[model samples]
Target: MPDPRTHLVGPAAEAEIRRLTRRSLLVGGVATAVGAGALAALRYGPDEAGIPWFLRRVLEGNERLARATFSNRLAPEFPRARAAIPRVNGRYGMAETTDSASWTITLVRPDRHDAVLTLPALYGLPRSEMITELKCVEGWSEVVAWGGVRFSDFAAKFGPAPGQFDYVALATPDGGYYVGLDAASALHPQTLLCDTLNGEPLPAEHGGPLRLVIPVKYGVKNIKQIGRIEFTRKRPADYWAERGYDWYLGL
Candidate 1:
């Protein structure tokens, strides 16, 4: 999990990135139209300042649009047909030495009631699988086969109807990076509490003990190292959204 204080892009950084991108693109366009020898210079300008935030945003938006246009409302696959799991990007919660034998998912309620569920308890739910595009906010996407129980099933066992809980929250054991999901997305038929990625137990880099997989959201919302899950009626604060990104970074 990433610390919101350290990993987030502040408003100032965002503004500068946007400004540089627009200037570079404008200069590049003008140079191209004039067939100027300076076109090469303009082409390399933005890269010199590091990639523009807006361009990165455009790439992410394009990915979202593409997935929305082409992805069928389908789930991932069985044990043998999963895609190769990608490298782990960060370890917020999963890095803690958890004794898998004793791990339990703690669910906090609006009334402050807390319920703890073990892995076997979670696995006992109606199982499901999904094959979907895992889109990262940083501009990459992959198709992964996931095997898990639907979140709705988990919700039902502990008592909330699929769409009844207003928010779902997850965090690493260290509480470094946390994300929140709305009820609609939480209960969406495609949302999964994944136990396997690409037919194997998730690699430590990819959030091993258990993680979330949802086609309708960017990777950030698919938090790793899930130490706790909470159901709330109010909108919960999210790690990235607090630092100036859109709260609904949905696909």
Candidate 2:
């Protein structure tokens, strides 16, 4: 058998090895510098400067575009046959188990009048069901069947003075995870205070009893185990938004 070592001892192989080593070193150096710069900026730089500033501006730009193009276009829905069970993604606000039987959805009207609502109260209103995709910011999506009252119906009866508020805020039972939405998107016909998933009472892990299902926006905006719904003239603080994700996470 020929000696394989002899082949790799040639001038051509040596030159190729040298070229590869140089390329690898150059790539490694650039990667390290970039990683270090990002870490330093995150640790030492001011929030209004460097990467944070750029991210803020990008988020603002995205909000502007989402608003400018705002439409009541209904998100396409599929047949129930196509729906799948959604994975439980996060439990930030759901760490504490809730008492579903006694759970109530509190509405803070724009006029400052507060109303407490029950699941039966929501069911008393006309119910709507849709099989729509819940798209997560983490790059996964699931088509699931959601049944509940139309947010429009809820707003019509309980919303703050019509058009009196520009934003709506929702928080979890523990007030840990929160999301804000523009009134237009919040009252969209498809937006639902969902109570049922896949023709059954929503499972606890899936934001059971009641949750917000806004197909027009990303799943982060669809807060689970909704405890409070407030109408506000100002933009409300959001959980993911504060952590550098886009506030208006529109589809």
Candidate 3:
């Protein structure tokens, strides 16, 4: 035999291998410890609205970023030819098949008296229309033509109630579903109290008769079958926000 250990590692090579293995184990142990600590911190951190405190801070930071860059330039309008009917994705307050005749919107402001207005009254303010994309938080969107009065116009005619810092809360008549909007967004010219979709009367399945069409925010904020509206200086409770979703989810 040329050498019995020819195929084997020499003593020096084996020593080097041991050293490398030990170094790798040491590095891996440190990494595992750091990773476990991080996981523990995330799990043990204080909770805000069911979100970890650090994560809520991140959400707050994103909200501030969105506000700092806020602009009136919204998504481009799609032509009527391109408008498509959006899929009905939610049914929180639309379960009841109430007659359209009974539909009324209750408007409230901190200082102003609450006013309940009929659909015809809203139409009386000023008829407006637009074709825009209704983007949902679930990563789907549709180009739909909308008809109603611009929320800005409605607010101007109602009582000019909202301020920059105020919030606008909207809900179905049953209050089973609700969403809050920053006054700035509620006053956007594109926001509308929609009654028609794709040139047809809104369907009940889609929160027909009267719904909110806020093109700037995700569809979650575009409440359907709005039965109540309130303008308040205090931030109102939001449905998705309470469930740990981004509250200020803007497009």
Candidate 4:
């Protein structure tokens, strides 16, 4: 009911006031929940890198969306002439002391005994080459030429084939960085166990000798200096996942 004396703030103005008041309350409640949940996460979550449970829920929802929406369409390829060197994403697994000559990758397959493969052995396999874009989570991208072995071919020869596993995981020798993948993406035709970049032997800065080049995922999922591979029926733990990043990390 409007008072005739308060005509200046009659129906429209009162309606606006009520709307703003409700919006303020809603915003305040959301902020309060976020703050409280963050505190709770800090006290009980995995580590300070962890976010609020509600945020995790949101990330999980995003993962679900990605799983539903993303396709296995081959990432577009460029002519080798257009390829350029990509910036080094990180060297978490590649230490200054790393000895590529002696590097060996451990493989753990669900259906077979664990095996160790020397880095040279991986390079000698039937070779594959591609010129494609590498997209980073930092909102940058580059077209690069890569030469290596197809992940599917490597798996079919040495480990479980694509459909044999529900998941795959890769890690660096020093255990500093790791990533998990769904089997589908792991065996995508564009996914490679690359050792060459832009027509040159891969430089140490770019995960030389061996690294994953998965065009279907953000660069984070294309782990560097892979020293271990696992084919599993379980969703293996991931380094960024513990730090509040989306586990799937799809493109």
Candidate 5:
């Protein structure tokens, strides 16, 4: 008998094989084109212009929405018994050794005047405490009791009128880490120039002497070991934002 393979390949079978082959090639080309398009999107989707134009636009839009709907909404407060110490995530801006007693927060007013403020001065302000959750960008949060003066009060008394400045820039003593905030958020009632945590003086690793506790923003904006604060008309540079993170990381 003739080989079954050879016997099966009649005229009609050859025609069918050609049709299937063409169909397969067409399908494959379409798939390849789709894959190439996806890769290109991943490679070039990010805005490459000087300021991440696309992302900045998106961020600005989000910011506008947030501001338009903004309220004096306060973060929920917990009982002191529910408060827990937060983990020390990073020491990017903290000094190995800090002199809490000698540490002073330097305020750069919008009018170019500089003022040195001490811990005593801060304590003398209308002191406030709130038991709120300190949420981290790394996906963990802890409720802690924070004691300090409201940032709004601080700015009104020592710095410029809250509305005069468009941005607030905070930096560590060594300038290792920094964050920028819009004037509204910086002057929010919940924003605090924190000094104590969990009913005790803030520990060194946890931004002792002074730190920012802003419930309106992610933990990154809660800068530690805050040494310098500037009220500016221009948006100040941010450490994470420069590395492609969203500049307006509102909660």
Candidate 6:
């Protein structure tokens, strides 16, 4: 099978590139007329170059707002049909090999206290219900039935109230991939530190030991192979955002 990370970037990047190309062309035409007697390149000027960048960010901002305003609605799935879900994509913060038995989740509190929660600890929490749309940045989506502990419960087990923190950052075991979530999305009614997908344990390739199920944001924000969850006031670094993607690819 092809690498899953490839699937995540192509469509979104292509669409943005095309949008930018058009603006570049239009701006080049205008620049040629203004600097006709001069020798500036016919490529996009600063004004034209700004179009796609601004639009892409604007698109990202729109997604964030939509998610924030989104009602905690569930996505419906069939009672009997089973879909062979795709293998996990993207592997920042995840190792090529992982051992779940040895995995641990760390909760960093505002008071500088640290609490460690294991996989079993998560399952021990009251299993919350969620059936939400997992919108991929690739533009496809699936409504999945997820059963796991509420992020709020996960935090409460350690320290600090759910709503007290400004941000929640999660990373894969390898620490190569990471994502941050705002307080509202972290504590959203539909957010879950999910262990089960489609009523079964998540496969090792699909963030096995633990993964986040955040309904308010796109799938990229639902960092898989979750190794740790830390509460902080600082904006967390995201793997995809550094690659020219939107930092806030919500909804």
Q: Each candidate's lDDT (Cα)?
A: 0.72, 0.85, 0.84, 0.84, 0.86, 0.71
In model 5, pairs of residues that clash are: none
Model 4, 36-137: lDDT tens per residue?
987786567654337656667777799888777767788899987788888876777676645678888999998889999997776557898899999998
> Which candidate should be chosen as best, given TM-score against the real structure?
3
Candidate 1 clashes between residue pairs 3 or more apart in a chain or in different chains: 1-91, 1-92, 75-130, 75-131, 76-130, 76-131
Name the regions of candidate 5 deviating beyond 4 angstroms.
Answer: 1-39, 45-53
Winner by TM-score between candidate 5 and candidate 3: 3
Q: Which stretches of candidate 1 lie over 4 Å from their true place?
A: 1-82, 161-164
Top lDDT: which candidate number?
5
- Give one digit per residue, the lDDT tens place, for model 5 in 1-251: 77554455678679877887999999999999999987677557766333445667777798889878877788899988999999988888789778878998788886867888777877668998999999988889999999888999888878875567899999998899999998889988999999899889888888987899999999989999999999999999998888767787888
lDDT of 6 by residue, 25-107 (tens): 99998988778734333233232223345555566678677766866555454442444364466666666556668888777
Candidate 2 per-residue lDDT, tens place, 34-87, comes to 999997886666664233676678778988988998999999999878999999
Clashing pairs in 3: none
lDDT of 1 by residue, 71-147 (tens): 43554433434465665666655574445567677888765468887788876788776677788888887778877
TM-score of each: 0.66, 0.79, 0.84, 0.77, 0.81, 0.70
lDDT of 5 at 13: 76
The true-versus-predicted C-alpha distance at residue 55 of model 3, in Å, is: 1.1
Give lDDT tens digits, candidate 3, residues 103-203: 88888877767899887777568788899988989998899999988888887777544453378899998899999988878888899988888889988
90 Cα displacement, candidate 6 (Å): 2.4
Q: What is the lDDT of residue 204 in candidate 5?
A: 83
RMSD of each predicted structure:
16.5, 8.4, 6.1, 5.2, 7.4, 15.5
Count clashes in each candidate, considering only residues at least 3 apart in sequence or on different chains. 6, 0, 0, 0, 0, 5
